[model samples]
Target: MATSSRSASTPGWPVSGAQSRPPAAQGAGGWTWALTAPLLVFLAIAFLGPVLLMLARAVSDAELPSAWPQTAQLLRDWDGNGPPDDRLAAALGTEILAARRAGTLNRVANRLNYDLVGSRSLVYATGDALERGASVRGFADLARIDRRWINPAVWTAMRHAAGPRTSFYLLASVDRRLDGDGRIVQVEREQAVFVDILLRTFLISAVVALLCALLGYPVAYLLATLPSRWANPLLILVLLPFWTSALVRTTAWVVLLQTHGVLNEALIGMGLIETPLALIYNRLGVYIAMTHVLLPFLVLPLYGVMKGISAAEMRAATSLGAGPLTVFLRIYLPQTLPGLLAGMIIVFTLALGYYITPALVGGGADQMVSGSIAFYTNQSLNWGMAAALSLLLLVPLTLMLFAGRYLTKSVPV
Candidate 1:
């Protein structure tokens, strides 16, 4: 009593009780890699790679040792707690004279002088002052000519210059030190700078963000409530600033807000004041220009959210005996919170990186982190310190963005 065999047309596969299926090549997962390959490649080149390279420079002590490997190796065994070792001193003396003969002492001096005030001239003058056949004794005699060389600070820095690499610049920015005796200590309160700059940057960014929200809210609401024909045109007007360069816009503000500029002239004509007010080159000017530049960032996000909300919600609240303001506050405004948060974050982050407007319009007191970064990178050529300051800015910017994303997710639609 053999069972009959199933035909090819059977519902199940040839094997009993097994379902028929397409080949693995036909599955959705087969296309996943092909679709996401471009994104993976883009992130590697455009994001992660550059960030790692930039961060490396913060701790990179490249020049002083890489060029003089023997001198660096000789100094490695010398305990920096006391005067330099005779062997280490002899090697340095030789290197210094050789570098001087090659007309390259200025390069080394320039590198060391980055964080140290007035060390360039000291190095240059010492190099020129060296006599033929002069040994380590002459270099050590530098203390007699300049009392500053007697301080342990310069020696501590020289010890750092003998390293494979170091975090000295990063530590110095935070007012911490790796002393000649190989101990870390807090610098004097007055000598600490990065912490103050960080606080100032945060405060300025927060203020500018708040001001943008205040100015943009009413404009966003009006744009959202107006008829499409009117709203579209107004939105174009609001977005007009994007068409112009940021530098041009900042410069325009400088011209308008100057002591005797159009604003003052108009105020004087209207008899609003007895004399021209101090509008430009101050914190007030920084706030005004930054807010103006950042307002559209606030408005666009908020307008998008507001436009999505149904007028019926407000109408329903009003019909239930809630006042207009109450309806907006309890119903409409709650829905717009996500957008407001998003706008605030964007504006704040942009303001934190602001250099041009603040530099051109802001007085000495109003300069932001970016201005400091530029000063170090360009004028002072202290790449390590510049990188550290930049990293300082990046931390908060990243945290704010993360918080914004979390807030957006937790919001109720």
Candidate 2:
């Protein structure tokens, strides 16, 4: 065989193999970078950056350490099994004098009081007692001012408060804590708020999702089964809410569902009731408004999925002597499962984060996790607790989203 000499400098190829390699690599890399840059920037600015900043604030313990670094450090070594050491007492005394001189004692006391009810008066009294020549020997002297000061539980909380950083806000969200001896314990029933809020949030979300699915299923079927001209217009109407501002929609619902609104007026006109019912400021109004807002989310997904399904299979089933209900249950319904699941996931996830509707329509008992988050953020200015609560909400939401995806993949079309 005559070996044709393959010149490295061939015009069709490259002078060296290395010369060809770089262009291919560069093209691939350039495309990857071009595709990924937007996503990375979006995540950095929108998702990851905010989340990290919020998480940092959750454990910040900003006020305590900024006010009394020495006292905080002294408490670090405290076992909290019994009285704190004299060094801790002295450190507290020193910090108190310094805080008083700096005029930050009241601010620090106020900050602590936000976390622990009545802590402001306790800290102020402790400072006064120290100034009046109270013995700075041990926790016993601190207890003389407020009996709660002696409790191991109180000391544990103090140690956390004195930290350069702390997990108190995170722990408190789940009704958990490091007790006096530094052992994790269930928070007292009266202090346990998050668990109830979490449960209520999930319960409300589940109810909304179910209601949406039930109401949307028939509507989606109608849209899918109808003529395209009619279905398209109806679909536009269904999606009309998306174009409107959420606040406006919620406010409209508030006005419409109120006792004196059109609904009650109609009821009275029809002689359905003797008097106007308590509709707006309750769970019933919350459900009504949320269902109205979220039903489209359920319908669109289901309608889209149902639209793609071939009608021939259902026709074949019907031709085989299968009844209408039987054909729907066996052939049609199974195909709509993906839509049902997607709608449920969307409705449930959105409902979990609902704030405005519940705030406007629901009473205190119906308030969801998002309402609690807003309360911490706006009312209390407790960003740490707000972030922790938000994180708690995120976990289950992420799980549900992934579970939805998994279901979509595993379920047969």
Candidate 3:
């Protein structure tokens, strides 16, 4: 009894042995890890695994090496200067013939075509010539098979591709490529579309996020300040869109924003305009649809934060001779900023990757990076390009998320 009293009085001291729990009870504490183990394993396999695979696909360059092993090895040593040597030319010809017989020449050709257009036919024609007994002892003989075989650009592309990894996909995604001298250069203005697409993606996402904040702040404030009877119904209305499919909502916007649609007809009946506005199939429609869809995301989080703020604080400020605008700007706005930042980040990141609404409602000028990613994945089957574009999209979002997290932590509630 004396030892137990001492154990209870002395902090950080071990309990008396007589008072300690059984060994079985002590072991039960380990169940915490056991309970969480399944979640850790699931996240590793489902999320981390695919993210690593995407990173690998963006940089892996195995097509040429897999299809033309010997030639790829030889080309790796070549400086990618003027032209290939006699031995390198002969090896390339031999490997092309071997790959043709093995039915893998198409893979090498298709990979090369990614670097230089028309390279597929160039590779196929040369393979056919070599198969037809066109002896290739040097660059001259290979050139006879196909004149493009002598072009430094083709050889440079081949040398660039002779790798266990390459930056071609990542570079191409940003409208850049290696020149014959192995220096990075901008692609021709005509071919430089990805940069524009990427900029347009960010611009559209920023606009949508801004619109959501502007439209959602008052709605969320009302939801927080109104009486419970009114607030409950209003919140349900805000959440109603979540129950419907995003695709269905987007399609409904299309119907409402079209030239002869309800909005235009209503305006016309009130003599608002002489002709139907070009609202649909443009940037305006993209803003309208995305803002409507993402407004709840902003409102819900902001409303949650706003509800936590004390009405007494605002009243105290007002009693101290503060005006309504002064009370809000100096007292309330700072408290709600973290929630606003969270909602804006959520809406912005979602808008960054938006594909369907923009594709459906906006014209050709409004296609985002996701459209290009989808085109590469489904149509062109260029997994590298798709993965590279995905990384470009992920990088900015990750930076913004980190910044928002820092701001939320630093700002006083």
Best by TM-score: 3
Query: What lDDT is reached at residue 279 by model 2?
Result: 89
- Tens-place lDDT per residue, model 1, 1-413, is 13334543456444523234456645657689889989999999999998778767778776677655666786666666666655665576667777888777776677667546677787666566554444555435655545566666676676677666777777877778765567788777888877777788889889999999988999999999999999999999999999998889899998899989999999999999879999989989999998998899999999999999999988899999999889978898889999999999999989888989888998888887888889988987777778887887887689889989999879875
* Candidate 3 structure quality by residue, lDDT tens digits, 36-125: 999999999999999889778888988899988888898888776567889998888888899999999988888899999999999999
> What lDDT does model 3 reach?
0.91
TM-score of 3: 0.92
Would you estimate the TM-scores of all the predictions? Answer: 0.85, 0.84, 0.92
Candidate lDDT (C-alpha), each: 0.80, 0.84, 0.91
Q: Name the lDDT value of residue 276 in candidate 3.
A: 97
Better of 1 and 3 by TM-score: 3
In model 3, which runs have C-alpha deviations exceeding 4 angstroms?
1-30
Q: Specify the poorest-scoring 10-residue window by lDDT in model 2.
A: 1-10
What candidate 1 gets wrong by more than 4 Å, as runs, is: 1-36, 39-43, 46-48, 115-118, 129-131, 137-151, 183-192
If the candidates were sorted by their lDDT against the true structure, best first, what order would they fall in? Answer: 3, 2, 1
Candidate 2 lDDT, tens digit per residue, 1-413?
23345553345856466566766785897899999999999999999998899967777786878888888877776655667787787678778867877888976786676556777887888787767777566656666766877656555666778766788878989999776556678888888889998999999999999999999999999999999989899989999999998889989988887889988889999999989988888889899889998999999999999999998998899999999999988898888999899999999999999999899888988889899899989987878889889988888889889989999878776
Residue 48 of model 2 has an lDDT of 92
Q: Which candidate tops lDDT? A: 3
